[model samples]
Target: MNEALVRATIPQDLVKVLGVEPRTDSQAEAFTRSFLKNGIQPNSRTDLNSMLSHKAVVLGYARPKKDKSKTKSKRAKGLNARQKRAMKIFHIKPEHQRYELFLPLHELWRQYIIDLCNGLKPSCSPQFVQQKLLKADFHGAILTVIRSKCPSHVGTTGILVQEFKHIFKIITKEDRLKVIPKRNSVFAVEVNGFVSHIYGSRFEQRASERSAKKFKTRGTIDL
Candidate 1:
């Protein structure tokens, strides 16, 4: 808890492990007290040594003590700050929510989407946009963003899903050929290929097609 208490309690030999050879017990105690005053915890001698060694590694005073055996080497490898940051993949910042779920798009939101499309995230993956969408809990993400940024807007699952699809170019050009006429022109909409009338068209169209095929099968068997 207290630096004075920690120094008084930790062994003089372990304090020397910090690379400061003590001329006396008091010197060793002072040396140990100088660093890790705030972090020091009351623990057993072995645990105290391990904690100090870890602190030394973090401050660049020492590399983690290595072992010759292969198994021990793997176990000793601890992730530093840089490694932890590297582990975090691409994520959209909250500012990107300036793009409303509906029309009248903002330039900032549009530019952010463009950045994602162009592989502007950390790595060179062309599919980062698709990955971002797939990894997200679609409905939950929409609700979260809307609640946090656009609290006044009453957005639905269909509206958010369509907006996401238009932004990410999830719909194929061939699929658009038949339905484009049922909706506004691509350029007319803030998000290209987004037609208010055709928002839920894909789902309804697929369901109808499946129902028609099932009906035809029944008709054939009856005959």
Candidate 2:
């Protein structure tokens, strides 16, 4: 199938993939646009259909959610090719993004760890992580924030491991540092006080501004 047809059909497919259906056509379009804008690829109608069918089957036999306190047997360290592909196309609406499409790194990391415990193999590479975050519907503005806040750590495997270890106490420091990156350089420090200027994330600020404007408009209409 052509890209246009695949793109056109993705919204309906997503309704099946993700249980929550958008209420209106505009909302559905918005959600579809976000998925396409990010890295969600609908290779072909048949492949997309087959993948969703498999997902449905998997959901039927899916294991119950794991408790963090309970000790679980560790699997392999890195994900295989098939597992990597699965992670790339996995589509579930982020719980924290009910109000908006962005979430904090802390929350994202927490969810990532939980998925790890549940036998999900996450992409350890920095570039893969960036793409995964975007595909997961995190706003692009977050890259700006992360780059500024952690300039020294950007694109470095060591810092990625350190941050993951810091958030989720499961991974050993030695094990975390084992997955070395190709590059480890503290390049130009584009240090900025933008993150410090805002109380929360840029997404949060934008959401607040939109909400205030909407509320004001509604009040005027009522008046």
Candidate 3:
């Protein structure tokens, strides 16, 4: 679309919402002509305002309107040499600092986790690490960590269960002879307790399951 039309037609509310001051008649119209003549174009909402992978947000994308740079044997235009110098002197250059940064995913995740942990009420506790594993299909490992530490799974499960329960009793005051759930069959590896890293990280779900097996072996190995 013609940038002039955009400048003329775009809603005032949109400019205000984007925090960009609405262009006055002279500047907007002049810039629009310069842009069209120079083969540079205006970007719409999506392309113009974007968050880079590194979390930096660019407010505008002012790329060349044409790909004339790749054309060879292209003759120069009728603009005089002194005019060219003046144009260069009066050109508006895009600067790096002009961009605005939106929220980055990683930072969002970190804040979310911290907020959840802090906001754990008695009625509904937030278990990020545990839930994250389970959601990622690491259910096998979650059980392993819980069960391996259970005395209810001794022979059918492992001596580790009883031993872990012992430590649980000593550490958690409520753990004194509580009726712990029996260990699930075919699930023995606790992730947090394991020292070896899991493979196939590309398979996030399966990898999470295997990786989570560590929490079991990495459990308190009694001295």
lDDT for each of the candidates?
Answer: 0.34, 0.33, 0.35
For candidate 1, the 10 contiguous residues with the lowest summed lDDT are 176-185
| Model 2, span 116-159: residue lDDT tens | 33423343533433223222321212221223244544443211
Error of 2 at 4 (Å): 88
Query: Worst ten-residue run, lDDT, model 2?
Result: 162-171
Residue 72's lDDT in candidate 3: 65
Task: Judging by lDDT against the true structure, name the best candidate.
Answer: 3
Candidate 3 all-Cα RMSD: 28.9
Best by TM-score: 1
Ten residues in sequence with the least summed lDDT for candidate 3: 165-174
lDDT of 2 at 44: 37
Rate residue 113 of model 3 by lDDT.
38
Residue-wise lDDT of candidate 1 within 137-220, one digit each (tens)?
222121111121223322222123223222311222122101121111111122222111222222223322423433222211
Instruction: Give per-model TM-scores.
Output: 0.16, 0.15, 0.15
| lDDT winner, 1 or 3 | 3
